[model samples]
Target: MIADFDVSSDWHVAAPYGFLRGLRHEQPVFHSPHLGAYVLTRHEDVRAAYGDAKRFSSAGSLTISRSLTQATRDRLGEHGSFLSSFVANVDPPDHTRLRRSVSRAFTPRAVAAMEERFRRLNEDVLDRVEPDGRADFVPGLGHIPSTKLTARFIGVPESDEEFVKSHVKDWFMLFLSPQPADRQLELADSFLEYLAYVDRLVAARAAAPQDDFTSLMTSLIGSELTHREVVELISTILLGGNDTVPNQLGNSVYRLLRENIWPVPADLTQNAVEECMRIDGASLGSFRYAITDIDLHGVTIPAGALCLLSTDSAAHDETVFDDPETFRIDRPNADAHMTLGYGIHFCVGAALARLQLRTALDVLGERLPGLRLAPGQPIAYRKSIVGRGLPALLVEWD
Candidate 1:
């Protein structure tokens, strides 16, 4: 049954609720052959599942596509101890410790201080596009600010900025598609290169630290995290911080332009970003392996079962948001949407993402007053079930 759903064309649409809505209504814990796991779709059920991490563990493998080759898994295994350092892969006490190490960096005070830098970065990227009057927003302006900001945040040298940005797409793509062996090896090489770069950054911070995430990480150098754990944590930060924001930024702009709203108002752009995330977030859903059998809505989810919490469905739940299909910027409850997962695994970088989106829109609107999508060109979407965004969004202005 799971395999059947996996191969279905509808799977591409993501919100498979149109097909599985009945199952969710009758049996919220139906087994999906495609995923080879039990899917939890209802908003309430997913919320419950997310809140009770004790019942649904996060320690195991957590991707939907069960087709990942053993080679891919093996490559991931190279991290070994580092793998457990990422907050998403741990449970409870460990997750708490890892999350705290970097929590101060994301506080309201810290993010507010970075607002001007974000604005300046946004303008700098837009300036490059202004002269062309046409540009590929994703790889062009869209990726710049986040890449620059993330590098700066981690205290990585400015010289390595371009090198780091160049690999962001490829690194993200490995999980998005099944690439040729050579391409996979190249990505693995890039991943290790990035790991080494971060390791050096960590060491540099320890030797001569500054007020940055790297410095904060350095403070924990002799604590619970060892040198390898530090490297993994930094790698996780780079991976998480790099791709998602840029994609969200690009996708939000693409969506606004596609809807014929060029030069979207900052407030509206912020709203649109929220809606896009709710509608088609980069992360399709987060995975958790069931630690024990649990019955939900008349269906039994067995122990060791992989349970998926559908963020897309939860966002569109009619009970939660009225007229879930219609994309309205003025929707009152738009802020309540959960593109970021709920409960324990809720995205720690949510504020950073919002800042990027808000800054992007503000700068673009102010600088490119006439920005709009090119009349006849089709916007190309990145091909990935795990995430969604535009790879190239060509646009022109008056």
Candidate 2:
């Protein structure tokens, strides 16, 4: 029966729900032809997989499509492992060290210091939209704030602003879908270009040493990281900041508009963002590899088997949440959503993402009080399990 199942279509349509129901009712640990991995769908099972990093390793090629070429893996491994130091791809000791190196810059104090700057930037974007009373919120407002904030964090000059934003989106897209070979090479080229740009910035920081993250990272240049490692580290920072925040902002607006809400309260916007991410996360699930044959909730998952934790389903589990299908801003446990992930590999930028989302909504509410979706137009959904969001969010205000 499982052999005939169309895993791709099933995953594409109902997403984690399709897989979750199957796992809970029929097979808790079953192989998926599309992902070529064993999917763990139940909330308890996903939580177990997340908590036990020893039993479930993250240091492996963890893509849904098992179609990656050996050359691609070798290329990634050689360039100081573009996928490695990002914290999402590594295990304990190294992950801990790499994360700590940049953690100082993202502290609450540092984040709070930028509030005035963010407010100004947000208002500037809002001003452009106010005159027109309608705009594509993603590119116009949503993408700009996150991209600019990340640039500030890395101390990349505002001159290179457009350059960074242009390439970053393509980098995310490559991870989402199987693009053509030329497009793949173009994506890799864009990444290389960004890395080279950071290299120059790092060198400048070493000479002049400004009071910014670039200087902080540059201080460790000779001791902790080589030139390439520094580039990869900054690239990871840019990628993380660039990829998710815009989607969260866009998804938040889309949800609010869909539900026919107006003057979205600051608290409601926050709740709506959490619920939307829980329901349609930028990432469908995260990947792990079983380190040892282990029995979880009566299901035996063999060693070296690829594992998928259905986070979307975990957030919507009927056992954990009441009326899981409803979008309730007032839900008591709404903040406990799993979109940022859980346990060892939880999103390091969770706080930053939240701040950006909050700032966007706060500014939008203040400037565009009557914001609403354009009547009868459909919001386009982006295709990618790693990141799910609207491609565009069209809105109008009087």
lDDT of 1: 0.72
Screening candidate 2 with a backbone cut-off below 3 angstroms (N, C-alpha, C), the clashing residue pairs are: 282-387, 282-388
User: What TM-score would candidate 1 get against the native?
Assistant: 0.90
Candidate 1, residues 1-398: lDDT per residue as tens digits? 22224423545543455654565556566677666677776778888888998898888443334334556557757652335556777887878877777676789888877879989988887766688878877777887788888888877778988777666555555544567766776776676676777777887888888988888878887785567667766666776667888887777776676666667765677777788676656666678888898977767788888887866667778888788777777677786666777887788888888887887787887888787877787655555555666667787776
Question: Alpha-carbon error at 370 in model 1, in Å?
Answer: 2.0
Q: 112-185 in candidate 2: lDDT tens per residue?
A: 77777777888877777689988888787788877887888788788888898877666555554577665666
Return model 1's CA RMSD, one decimal.
2.9
For model 2, what is the C-alpha lDDT against the true structure? 0.72
What are the root-mean-square deviations of the candidates from the true structure over C-alphas?
Answer: 2.9, 2.8
Residue pairs in clash, model 1: 1-33, 2-32, 2-33, 2-34, 3-33, 3-34
Q: Worst lDDT window (10 residues) for model 1?
A: 1-10
